[model samples]
Target: MSAELRLASGGAPAPETVHPLSVRGLTVAYGDAPAVFSVDADFPAGTMTAIVGPNGAGKSSFLKGALGVVKPLSGEVRAFGGPLSRARRRIAYVPQRASVDWEFPARAIDVAAMGLYARLGPFRLAGRGDLDIARAALSRVGMERLAERQIGELSGGQQQRVFIARALAQGADLYLLDEPFAGVDAATEKALVEVLKGLAAEGRMVVCVHHDLSTLQAYFDRVLMINLRKIAEGTVAETATPENLRLTYGGAAQAA
Candidate 1:
């Protein structure tokens, strides 16, 4: 199964539109200082993209705008070649682990099942089919053994894996993950990367908010350098250069 769980659209996007993700004149801000300036880019389908930038870069802001979580001060956001409203269900987001409360009483399986909410709605209960889907998703991350374990009982890496499993269950066409590898072990990181690669291989778009420059080339096919605005975006080998890295990270980053 691609991504430890297959998206509903298992095949490469039919190219209903030329690009899976596109941004035009998009702008967002907290106050007078704009977090993201007018940004324009086209992300083709079936690629793994890395969003890189300084700590305050609008990387997360960009994702939120695409997902309609953060209102753009100006400009437009599109998905699957259309407005987000048209493809909202086709998108799924995995927030950073630090933003989550590990002490929550939900089980690993429960978290994975949450992915079905988009399809289930508030009143409908998860049926056997949903549970089976969640089970398979957890197994993909090698966390099926702890399916019944509470989320609070899991380690940092385990929690990350579970969240990823949940993302898989969503059956989305495009996945937007925030800092997925933040506090995981080497093994977990490698395992998770493989799963994400499998998704791209299956023609699904996978985008992540990545911080580790060391793995930029190894993990993503494309990269977008952002510092309040887009610095450079292209192939990993071409765009992630030392000069560009310096420009994007300023004095805070070193060569990978």
Candidate 2:
């Protein structure tokens, strides 16, 4: 990750918030079939947390539920002790790269600038100030040199970085990322991990959906195991044991 992207040097201190993200009775369903059921968890501020489970697990669904992309059958999601919609600016979401069309013909900078659009309101074009923020975001992801390149032409890791840059440009305190490590090189993975750690160190909250168990110990401070319902939430040492993994993966598949 680029040093320029480091949490905008010396901003006002973050408020002493109890939970950056809190979910209670977070049940999600697609029509009559439920994906997640009665899940309750709190993601503390300034921490790096990972959500992991098998292919059929509702890890991605949980993220979508938190983002309000998918309605919950029952439950509540809060950010900074308020309604999620009220705190949207403080929350950034980076979806899986597969969720986007790479051939959509946007430049890296253009893609990053999309982050500013939500704050800019409807039908307004991005200005020079927005470009400056995009540039800073690209620099943070070590992709400043490729700011003008077509996003479709970049590697998977580079694409992921661009999305992250977009999130950085949003100036959010909480980030929710899905499958950020999929199909990326080791170097890119390392860079991404560094960026996440930097975010946490700077007193931001990051929650990622990940799969690889081998790197779990090094990548995250806490892990939330989930299937249709939350299996466990705590430090890796406290919750990532063999028993928990089995519980999260043992169930049948559900929608993302």
Report the lDDT tens digits of candidate 1 across residue range 101-138.
Answer: 88888999999999999999999989999999999999
Per-model TM-score versus the true fold: 0.90, 0.89
After superposing candidate 1 on the true structure, give the runs of residues whose Cα lies further than 4 Å from its correct spot: 1-17
Tens digits of lDDT, candidate 2, 1-256? 4654445446644345469899999988888888888889899988899998888578898889988999888899999889998998899999999999999999999999999988999899999998999999999999999999999999998999999999999999999999999989999999989999999999999999998888888999999998888889999889987788767776322321
lDDT of each: 0.88, 0.89
Candidate number of the best lDDT: 2
TM-score for predicted model 2 compared with the true structure: 0.89
Cα error of candidate 1 at position 38, Å: 1.3
Question: How many steric clashes between backbone atoms does each model show?
Answer: 0, 1
Q: Which ten contiguous residues of candidate 2 have the minimum total lDDT?
A: 247-256
The C-alpha stretches of model 2 lying farther than 4 A from their native spots are 1-17, 251-256
- Model 2: colliding residue pairs: 2-140
lDDT of 2 at 216: 87
